[model samples]
Target chain A: MRNAANLRVQVESMLESRIPSALTPKIKPPLESMSCGISDIDRFKAFGRGTLVEICGAPSTGRTTLLHGLLAQCTAGGEAAAVIDTSDTFDPVSASQSGVVLREVLWVRCGVPRNQGRALSRLDQALGAIDLLLQNGGLGLIALDLANVPIRDARQIPLSAWFKFRRAVEDTRTLLVVLAQQPNAGSSSATMLDVSQSSVEIEESDKPSVEKHIDGDCLIRTLRNRAEVLRGQMTKPVRSVRTIGEFSTSLYSYR
Target chain B: MLYAGVHLPNFPAQAALRNDAEARQKPFAVVAGTPPQVRVVALNSHAKKMGLWVGMTKADAETQSSVKIRERLVRLESLAHAALQDCLAGFSPWCEDVAPDLFVLDISGLSNLMGTPVQIAKSIREQARTFSLYIKIGVAHNIDSAIHAARLTKNVLVLPTGGEAEILRDAPLEILEATPEILGILHRWGIRRFGQLAALPELALSERLGQEGLRLQRLTRGISTRILSPTVPSMAFEEEMEFDHSVEDLKSLAFVFHRLLGQLVLRLATRALAAGEIHLTLHLDLAADGVTAKEPFFTRTLKLPVPSVDVTLLLKLLQLDLEAHPPGAPVMKVVLHIEPMRPRVVQNGMFVPQGPEPQRLELTLAKLRRIVGEDRVGSPELMDRHLPVPFRMANFTPSNSPSRKLPAEVSQTAVRIFRPALPTSVEKVRGTPRRVRFSGKSYQVSHASGPWRRSGEWWTRGHWGRDEWDLVLVSGDNKRIVVRAYRDLVTGHWSVEAEYD
Candidate 1:
């Protein structure tokens, strides 16, 4: 009887080991991963809409020129754009020369105060106008031409204000572009396009000294935390500068 | 009653004064100084009849006219035009600056307030006379006729019905403002005067000049059918209320903000728009204090997701933000401006219902955004392919992102997960499995996988290069664990990086 009981126990242990007990299927949780892309523009393009692209630079650094180029591209793509001219610096003749369709661009002039006494009030009014355009949205490129805005005053824009603006831009496909003399306020996520005039030469005829003409070369640096790793400082020489009518046109070695 | 056109004859006395402020008596003519390559910008009317025409070079003008010449300054002309515009503001509120020193005024329904149009014109001319500028006035049924009559006849030109063609018949083609190319084409067709062009068949004109020619033909016929639509004034998203009592406290001011936000939201929703940014203005009630009313203080705009008309949400967000950064002083009246409301397109899903529910998501996100801020909320958006550490990442508002298509031919390699992996030190061995020590606990390796290596972005500022290994080990508890190990390319030290659950 003892030999028979031991045999039964041995048989049960072998069967349990060989047959394998029933196991529950592991419920796989949904994977949370971000969609990846190559470049900032590519990442934005994947979102499938025109975004706010800000081109900011110091004085006489081809800020307007770059803006005109972008505007032309947008128009060619059958997209509309608006310019909030806080400094009354938008020249239509130059815009047309840069290939922007004048009819397609909505130019809002934020008139400055003629009186020196009301300068602060005028500045506030201009900012209000800029705020209006940004909130309206639906623009392929809404450029705030703060290139002519005083850097000291523009710096007065609080950092929190920039964060709010960045938050406003978040998911919407609109590319928010701010054109300023310097990087004043924007989220760390903002793509900063910095432009600087490399060399400038002023030429005037000996007889007609009243006519002051200028020739200059500009260097544009597109810096972002998320751009391709380029070796050294990417530099391009701009050549051939001439003023046609009211606009100054230049040709660069690289596009 | 006001005429739309004006002309100024070149006064020889004024020309003499311009040539030499010292020489008081010599007769002179104001002539355009055109460079050799460029056309003459402008010329005095007196210089025109002296056989010196516009577009003539300075040398040519000197040879053609016997009268002593003084160059007309384009800058001075523009300045004078601006002065005239300012002066005309007394006559009409609406004025348009036309090119080459012309001003178009809409004197409609202002006859009683500013007297008759004729009286207004006389007042404007008188103002110009005070500035020592010569002037002419033309009154007509419409602007085109008035301008034409002022140019064609040196008097106010009135046109009734189809009198436009008759008046323009004898006028020169230059008055039509047609481009030189169109003029050359018209000259080829033997059409010189405005009357000749106006007399052509519309179909023929359309064929010759295309649409532009057709427009000119219509303009010349005194059709004057186009209405002068005034420019629409800029629209603002401002809501303001006068306080029954000029209370000046922070708490009361916050209440005013609540009420203003409520009104602003209603207006925004009615227009199907969402406010992306908002500005707060606090007006001080200093009228009783015998001081000039100061301008309202402007707050740096606060941006929001989706257009929200909710007073409570706005109040909560504003209160928190404002408390963190409050206004400088007490305010009497508060104004809220929710500007730049984007047109809200409510997309009703085909299979799902649409209502206030989805908006609730935006409100919830906004509340969370207000607390933790905009940066910490959303998924990391990959902006560039530079350093992995400093790669661009942005927080996006939660919304239906368009689905991303995964690229084909992806590697089927299993990805390692990092959970509670403790750093482990292992003694050197061959390229295969070996016993490892982790957290003062020893484990025996049963299975192993992986030699997956990744290199960092060395072309940029920061770079990393490491070789990773995945090893499965059995513990004394009879439980199995997978540990990932990597050797620092620089230091040549191996460390446990992660573990599989």
Candidate 2:
């Protein structure tokens, strides 16, 4: 009886192995993932294709820095990236230092208005642009940088827009990153990272650093003895809120 | 077979019917001449069935109350002829527009590019279908035989090589397109069909009827000793339409543009060419001293990134441009000129990531430009200078050319400049910024570096000088802000310049 039972078990295992793959449930391989180019944040979460990532933080919290890193990683892999810059705060010189290929990056600057009401209208246009870019697809990364946009104006953005973007990016290898002062996309995003500046440390120099800072619209620039870069750290929300490391990387330091 | 001919039957009636669809399937005749004595130039089959002949006087034709008559439009005849010539240009370089309703092409060596001569004839007929024009094609060893065969056949007729005379024997002498006097003399001689005309002695006909009769005899014998004077293709691919009335709405304008673009694209495709640029000139009906005048023109030229023949893409681009820069008055006439060029062949790199389609990319860029101001969208190109944020917006044309490898010593740090640098109040400790106040908020400068001085353009009155500093500031909440601030040396004012990403 024991020998007969062993034969039955062997026959069952052989049948299972012989079954065509089409007859069984497919085990999908893991999704293609990429790092945000920041070691501290990469450990907790990595961006994946066809996913929405939100980087929310107040002004001067390294939101722009995180955006640069994402763009850099995308372009460094020979992929193209774009920034729908609401409030017109994208600085190419600073972005290039974060390892972004400027040639591969498309910078679309939404008009910056001085009044609050006009600023809200500008936000609407920016959202439309986001939808346009998402529908167009083929982009490795599309960053909607609204960090400088008023929080109230950013809030006026309909939640349905986020869901629309989520649907547009599904089954595609494009990453949609929304950078804002606070979380605006709600639950539609696949990954939500809250960035904050924890501390500020200014490097000391004997002579004041004054490199040429061209302000064409204002036309005020001058040269100084030395250049300074400010570095800082944010440590909290170990799981959700990610802080930026390598704060010492300054504008002059990259060049 | 070396030559082919296209025959458009009842051309006048058909041309009129093209613009008046309701008149189709009706007994109609196109008449031209003085009113009472106006004679029918062409009549449709239904009209012919109604006993309306081409020479019938208008008054007599009107006696048949059911027959409809439309004045022959000379302009339409010319346009249709040009259109036919453009279409036939694709088959062979030697195309002769012999009449308003006739075309002959020299297809001597097109067997390799287009199959056999019969296939070429069929292809010509098929391409003409796009215009809803029905044409009969004939191919033969000589032009005269080809012309005769085209008129006699219902569709495509290919005469056997060296058998033109035998095949053309039954055709009517009118197929030769001979003069009325010669035709009258031939009729008096009882030579109605080509066989009777060809049976006459050539020397006798030449002696009696002169050159005209000799040519007729040669045509009847299916012989063409004359050289083919092919019309040279026009350099400019252009179409013009003058509206019956001024069009004030975009929809009507777009509709007209759609038709024009279709015809232009067909012309370009026939020659294996693409449009490099579209120069659209709209004649406006603007009021001069409150009087409607018609000379004002609004011209806009759209340059294509790559030569393209895609009608939809071209139309969209044109519509976008028109939307952005609308004419000041109603449009009375529109002319479209296409610059023709060979399309560029692009070979994508093996490792480079795929980008959006070039046509799509250009269209998307145009849309973005409309949404934002024109100067706000484009790839960033750094200006060659030490000036901060020294760059300008330019036309965006994506390059597939390989990017140059970066130097080992180039800096990796990039700075994002804030436009209209935020004006700030600074408390300087011995000419060094120690505190900053901007947007009703103040920050203590934890660390400050700079006083870098750069000034130039002394030759002009607009000279600039500034003291710059890169600072790490601590807000009241102890939130950190890294910024680059500058003080105007001449104005004695301070402003926040840019932030390091």
Best by TM-score: 2
The DockQ leader among the candidates is: 2
Fnat measured on candidate 1: 0.00
lDDT of 2 by residue, B88-191 (tens): 88777898878878888889888898897778888889998875577999898888788889999999999887687888889988877888988898899888
TM match of model 1 to true structure = 0.31
Worst 10 residues of 1 chain A by lDDT: A226-235
Best by lDDT: 2
The count of residue-pair clashes in candidate 2 stands at 31
- What is the per-residue lDDT of model 1 for residues B1-501, given as tens digits with 9 covering 90 to 100? 334666554433342242122332333445543355443434554555656655566566566544455555554454345445445555555665554445566766766776765675666677665544556666566776666666666544545456668867878777776899998888887888888888899997787679889878877887565445332222355655445356545666666676566545554554455666788776665555544435445365777656666667678667756654545444565667677567556675563311123334344334333333343223233233543222222332323221132222111111122222346666544454477887677878654444556776888666788766655566787545445677678877667654321
Across residues A1-255, which tens digit of lDDT does each residue of candidate 2 receive? Answer: 999777766666677767644233455444566566655556555466777777776665566766777777777666777889887878776666566677778888887432213343568668767877786767788988888888888888789988899889877878888887788887677676665554443333334335324211121121111111111111122234433333323344522
User: Under CAPRI classification, how is model 2 graded?
Assistant: acceptable
